[model samples]
Target chain A: MEVDKGKGEAEETRKVAEADRDTVTLKSSDGKLFEVSKEAAARLSTVLAGMIAGGSIDDNGTDLKQIGSEALENVVDYCNKHANSIPSAALISSSISFNTAPFKEPEEWERKFVDRLSHDALFDLVEAANFLGMERLLDVTCHKISEMMKGKSPDQIREVFNIKNDYTKEELEEIRQELAWAFYDD
Target chain B: MGRHSRRASPLDVDDLLAEILLCLPTLPTSLPCASLVCARWRRLVTDPIFLRRFRACHWEPVGVFHTIFQSGREHLSFSFISDPPPGSILHDRFSVPARCQDAGGGDDVYTWNVRGCRHGRVLLINMPCYDRKVHQFLVWNPLACE
Candidate 1:
């Protein structure tokens, strides 16, 4: 009976320790593990906040089966970087205004963070950010992609995005005629 | 968590595509130019819901429309002045009809006077040269060319 009582005390201690933990372990689709600050994860990602609040976080490694290892690594890196960086005054004010605020341009650090990624990596990170419900990350990544599209013609956009131009010559010409101003520079 | 099948490509998903497109520049030419990419993009951009969201996202005015009158010309021509100065393609597309059909099934020349412009729409009062009392109100949307 004494040994069982001691075992119960140890189990309670373990639970208490986990409750006090400042970081959470996440498992990628490929079974890789990543550690991120609990505060950062909860603050940045709505899904993570819900998971943490609902006590659904797994102490071993919360499985994120939708995210591959590379993308998950980028996500972790971004969270760590975001946690360390002090948000600017503009960001704080925008956060206060929330949805009504105009789209805020990504900061210089964020620009450099995404600019170093390969095209595939950037797309993968965007998917991961979206799946995890990381709004800021998704906004920064999407902004990077939209920047790639600006000032380019339809053919140039198609070439950049690798999309097929399904419109036949006649249909394309008709659309061009209808919105002639948009295509004048082309 | 329940297992879910992965999409073939991230850009293939409509939600993700909309998110990316939502971040496009606020310029008036952005959507029209993006719609030219493919039928799928055309469908997405032209969707009324997407258009509403686009307008909500970009609430700033991109250009202005004003009347240009020549020294001796009887008709007032409309001109669009792009705020950021887009290319020289703003001429013929923004022109309004100089003549409106009268009750007698004949085209009547009217002098158009600009009353107000708001929400991408231009309001004008058309007064026929023969009658000083006939005031016809015409609201023209240059973006829709209607």
Candidate 2:
């Protein structure tokens, strides 16, 4: 019984070591530990893939010099949490329903979760998503960014993105007048 | 330390940024405000590639309409010519309408005559302008009535 108990404890340690040690240690620009599973790490960007394949990522981890430390940390956390959930394909293909719904809500909690992000953070997340090859995540990020520019006047749009009026006043006026027919109706 | 291996200048950076920004779809947002702070940035935004990207974003949908005219009684008449798709939205999913359009406006094609139509089931009828009475023989195509 004593020998069996000792063997059981030893097996448990090995299992823990396997689970915990199997990681893609991403060293961010500021030297952070963005540990991720092999499956999750496979989603990383082209540059990272080269380093991963080359085994240049030392025993400690791979170094991601492009993305910042904080950003990399956030990305790893997102991946680890999301890895537990079902894949995107099964989720979207699954039929969803609600009761005889009259009044529609603007967004549910799930949508709100994604929506609650700053523009800069969203851009970083998109880069991360693209690197990770998270198609749905990338799509959501891009569409959110696109939504920012939709249906606003040219002046309003320029103002939102801090775009300089590079066009001369005369040129700007001409462009506005030419597309005047298009703007009013749509 | 004699010969310098020249690295890419600031212009290259601005050009790449401009290209990235241009790929996005039309939005109410404006860009290059930061890049346009200098003459080099100005050049990047004004590049032909940036302008071309904006040009490619949207296009006009082809419109087909038949302008109907009032005959004296409950009868009606109309005329239309199909213009090809404006170099866009031409996919296999689109099908030609059941009837074929016979071309007109030739050097001597008379406006009143259904000159060369072989299988046109409906003919466009034009009532004589300023006449209080509309033309009685609008339904020349027997298939249309059938």
Best by TM-score: 1
The digit string of per-residue lDDT tens for model 2 on A45-103 reads 44444555565656576666666765676677665655555466643431112111221
Give lDDT: candidate 2, residue A137: 52
Cα DockQ of the candidate 1 complex = 0.35
**Model 1: CA > 4 A from native:** A87-102, B1-7, B65-88, B91-119, B125-134
Give the TM-score comparing model 1 with the true structure, all chains together: 0.81
How would the docking of model 1 be graded? acceptable
| Pairs in clash, predicted candidate 2 | A43-A132, A149-B28, A157-B28
What is the TM-score of each predicted model, taking all chains together? 0.81, 0.47
Error of 1 at A16 (Å): 1.7
Q: Cα RMSD to native, each candidate?
A: 6.0, 14.5
lDDT of 1 by residue, B1-146 (tens): 11223435556778888878988986667888889999999899888888788777777675655454444333345443443225724554566545555667565656677788766678888888687566788887766667
